[model samples]
Target: MSEVNISELNDSQVIGWLNRGGLKASADGEIGLWNEAESALGALSAAQVRTGVSSGNSLQLQARDVDGTSWTSFLTLTAGNTPTCAIDRTVIGATTPAAATFTTINGKTPSAFGLSLWDAADAAAARSTLGVNKHYMSLSQSSGSAIGDGDTRYVTEAILTTAEGYATRLYPMHTGTITRVIVQTSCQAVNGSNETATVYLRKNASSDTTLSSSVQFNSARQVYDVTGLNVSVSSGDYFTFKVAFPTYATNPTGVLMRIDVEITY
Candidate 1:
């Protein structure tokens, strides 16, 4: 019928065209089908038809033909080398630090029972006393209280006041040798009399007494100090200091008084 080259034949047609589905070639030298012995045919492989199921290009691997223990060598194909992408180099900063804020209030109340200094209505000018040692003191009256060794009570009505003068008790209750003293005072004034006061260090109604200091004032608030005055106060002892206006001086400018006394041993 028609003459056709075997190489140009379709795959299915070539298979059927061969007698017994095989070919007769000269030797296993070129790319031609060979028909040696059945064992020799086993060394040759059929051409594999691979189909790609995904959208990517197809990839092929090197294959060999094997006999009992030997194989036909295969040539390497340099076709599919995957390409690499570049990476960017950079230094990114971290998040900023948070700011600080205040959380609570810190405050304190004023000291009520310590040495106090205030002006009186009778003094011609301000008076200050320094270094007057304290022995012991307390506010036992219904209206006032005192601060003493080993005593820790802070309350109002621990101080006494009047137009003429004020009174509180003191005792030297300490552990070591008694050294110096501090005194605080406040007073109410009466008319025409210069604001005057007498601070005392005494044991009782009939005992040893010392006039450590005094003050004179002409107004509502005043402060006075008696310093370097030799007076003694110790631990676990009682002493009293009375702030009084000179009596028999008729209608002296009277005022309420406050006293803060401190002693060191």
Candidate 2:
């Protein structure tokens, strides 16, 4: 029969064969084992359980659900970052780290007024190159005359093409409407007299009917705000200004400055 000294053994070993399985101590003394029945019974023991770290710079957080179930992380470990760093939606903004492009309008010579069109050459600054559009038109001075009667009819409108002008850039608005017309002229007559000049808007280079008319080029810069006129302009519809020399004998020679027509939607 095997014998155990009571002083050197525990209650579990003493009553092992007599009662339900009891506690036992291992040789290493690191672990104390108990029987399944005794462990399930009124066993209330104190243990140094790890609740959280104290004064630790790094902390490990376990993801859990509302039901207290642990969950796995979805993201992979990245190469260049600190483990403690975090990214949240609250710190995010509307934009991203991608390149953005914008649209613009440009001006060219020969166009009576400033002309603009869509170009793809990335020509924004003065040094950048610009891609010219073939369909557009360009306007420039056609002829020069001495100071004569205040005859705006002497002004002419020709086809504005890329090859003939300094820059092949001009666009006509077919469906758009003519918002305004401005005519600049130099009355070289010695008297510097206020003269009445007739302005005309012709369709297709035919100086027949004036779509719109102005009476005087009193100053060097004559402007006619046609927004109230409500004139409809189409693609093929182009215009020219005419100067009527009422006092031709007094002012024999007259000079034409510029005629500008603006069409907008």
Candidate 3:
């Protein structure tokens, strides 16, 4: 009979031989099967099998044992102790994150990312149609108006009066908290002792005036900026600007004015 030592084989060679129904003997020789109860077998050396696997390599189990235990061992590929596996979305199985759970993720803070609709809602605010939380709108009147002697008429709505040479324009504002309103006034020539121009912001019409500011023009052409006026506006509400001369003895030529409104949602 021929004898084969099991210690001289590797794992794959033993498995291959077992798959083909055990080892074959030389011609005209019978194979001898040695039992562990009768003979002692030597342990295989650790280096007898292949070693030194490449980095980022992994192993997977082929099957489980009868008791549901894994028979094969697997290598978990990682970089700097962190697993480099790609997790599928299906594996997460969560639709949304817990409250305040996403304040930071993967070492990134919320301020570093763009705000979504849900984020805006949480802050009790909303984005406009232009995807902006705050915006500035401006309206200007460039046509020259002459404030004649002793003119005290409050001009509302853009109207060119042939008798008084004054006009007004209506400004439509969006629904938001008005942060600031800046009114700028400029004049080319002033021909009166006290040439003062009063600018008033009227809500809805001429009667519902909310805020007003005045600027006095000297002998030379000058520009004035009126700022720090806060007012809250609602949807469908319109505003009008009234430019009136209170103490003008002679007409003021080349009068220009602009209004800037800052709003936040």
Best by lDDT: 3
Error of 1 at 189 (Å): 6.5
Q: What is the C-alpha lDDT profile of model 1 across 70-132, one tens digit per residue?
A: 433232112224422222212213433343232322443323321222222222222222333
| lDDT, candidates in the order shown | 0.36, 0.40, 0.47
The global Cα lDDT (0 to 1) of model 1 is 0.36
Candidate 2 matches the true fold with a TM-score of 0.34
- Higher-TM-score candidate of 1 and 3: 3
Question: Estimated TM-score per prediction?
Answer: 0.32, 0.34, 0.45
- On residues 33-118, what C-alpha lDDT tens digit does candidate 3 reach at each position? 21223221111234231111334433221234458664433322333334354322222233543435466657766553343543
Q: Which portions of model 2 miss their true places by more than 4 Å?
A: 1-143, 147-154, 157-174, 188-192, 205-225, 252-254
- RMSD to truth, every model: 32.2, 19.4, 15.3
Clashes of each: 64, 18, 2
The TM-score obtained by model 1 is 0.32
On lDDT, the stronger of 2 and 3 is 3
| Number of the top TM-score candidate | 3
